[model samples]
Target: MERKTLITSTRNLAQLFATLEVKEASPQYSLDLAWPNSHNISVSIKRDDLLHPIISGNKWRKLKYSLAQILGSRTLHIVSFGGGFSNHLHALGFCCHRLNIRFTAIVRGDYSANPSPMLHDLQMWQTDIQYVNKITYQQRESPAYLTLLHQQYPNALIIPEGGSNKLALQGVAEIISELDQHYDYIIAPVASGGTLAGLIKATAHSATHILGIAALKGQGYLEEHVQALLPQTYQHWGICHDYHFGGYAKRSNELVDFCNDFYHQTRIEIEPIYSGKLMYAVKDLINRNYFNKGSRLLILHTGGLQGSRAIGQRASIL
Candidate 1:
């Protein structure tokens, strides 16, 4: 089953809405391990602490449960799809390097003459990069899409565009197990919707509200993605509606300045993509009294700070 019990502090406030409390089962989904096979090499950060360069948050979360299914018998060639400035790609590049695995990336959009600095750095990591038209790129989540990809590159361990899948979900859901079970809501950005969907699926109907902030503009389709993973019982979710500061990868100097100010205040680092939006909404909701004053809030840090390295490259160049 997907791990549980751990709750980030932002979740604490969400529990106050629990008309009733309950325990739910979010069993393990798929698995595909790709990491150090060196037996007896124990590390200090029991939680996927691959060298800091290899990464910290989403890398471990996306890999943990996926590794179990691989059975650890091969020199995995890790491959995934992403955009030019993708943090998932960055994490995959670094993680694959540390795990002694080959890495490949299928990125969407035309290649810029000077791509985001993050994309530039991944090249130095020796991750092979391929570009595809956006139409085919958007089809990445489909099983058929993956099958077609395998026909072309049959020997790679495939991760979806965002490292998004039931397996990656299982990995992230495991983070909940590390926290105290006293949260009212858990919020994350709605990207491919896998992370938010997995969270709600794992939490089930535990009375804890799962609120996903849509960084993508006009993301009503995320509701469709959530429905794909959850039962009708999850009809009572509290996914928030207004946080996109334009659209994915779109931002303003206001947000940039806000992030700097927010970091000074909370000592918490939230990337403009996910946690930053959550932080903005969380504070707003608290002020409007949607959240109880004394309630606790657990804002998940889905970790995409790497995208910030190339701030000058975003399209929302306001």
Candidate 2:
């Protein structure tokens, strides 16, 4: 897909967002995993990672409508929060750069001295970086702090950490329409629960069941987070918090090995932070006979390959 030229005109910006072009279709490929249980289950992956080069996977979906709102309004600056290796900030910075808008990233922890590959990419995209202590970072969502931020940067649109908002949910809901065939299960990685919330909302009345593998430790609060985004009660979805490996952004030798093996087998790159853990959970569940025989499963490959750079020795463990 051709990149849209940057424009300052409201009409042109509206048109650009209205007709934003992403890769028409991301190819889905069948995956073969050695399951411990004797059951007839088929697995396939929706390669949302191929949606775009930078704004890939669920990040693009989350940002689609958020950017539209920013451009449609008089907001000239976009402010958001993330960690050192945040794909959310990386994608948001790239989008802001392409759209000719200013992006300010409030980074968690004092990572200004040592930058990761994701942070470097954000810098390359001309994102204004601000380092904050953990204490201040925790106040990111406080009403007083948000009010202060608005006062500091007038006309700036503050996107929640991970871009998990109502607009983001709307964009993620569109992912369901991209699937050509129906499956019994739809599984995705859950961080802040925006993508899973969107999927649950889209499949609330369908026969398909939505499973969210939490990517963070103690993510039971994700149920409430997802419920807040959805308009009505959704009972077709459940979350599994056992696959985080260690915790958010934490990796292990086993995870690295799995990621390497998965890439070698499927020719698809997966970062340990999200997609790797998701595949790990899917395989573990399959082994434990979690799915009925003859069940078809669809896994969402929400991209974060850029984060693989920070894996250090673990990336070479395989």
Top candidate, metric lDDT: 2
Tens digits of lDDT, candidate 2, 139-253: 9989999999999989899999989998888888888888888989999999978899899988877999999999988665888888888899878999999988778878788
What's the TM-score of every candidate structure? 0.75, 0.91
Please state the error at residue 187 of candidate 1 in Å: 2.0
Inter-residue clash pairs, candidate 2: none
Give me the runs in candidate 1 sitting further than 4 Å from their true place.
1-54, 142-144, 231-233, 312-318
lDDT score at residue 98, model 2, on the 0-100 scale: 79
State the number of backbone clashes in model 1: 27
Candidate 1's residue-wise lDDT over 1-318, tens digit each?
A: 223223422242233112112112122111121212312121111112222433445554665444333324353777788888887788777656555567888889867577777678778888888888989898887889889888877776787767667777776676567654556666667777777766777777476777787877755677887676554557546567687888887766776666666666544455677656766665566556675444445666566666766664223322
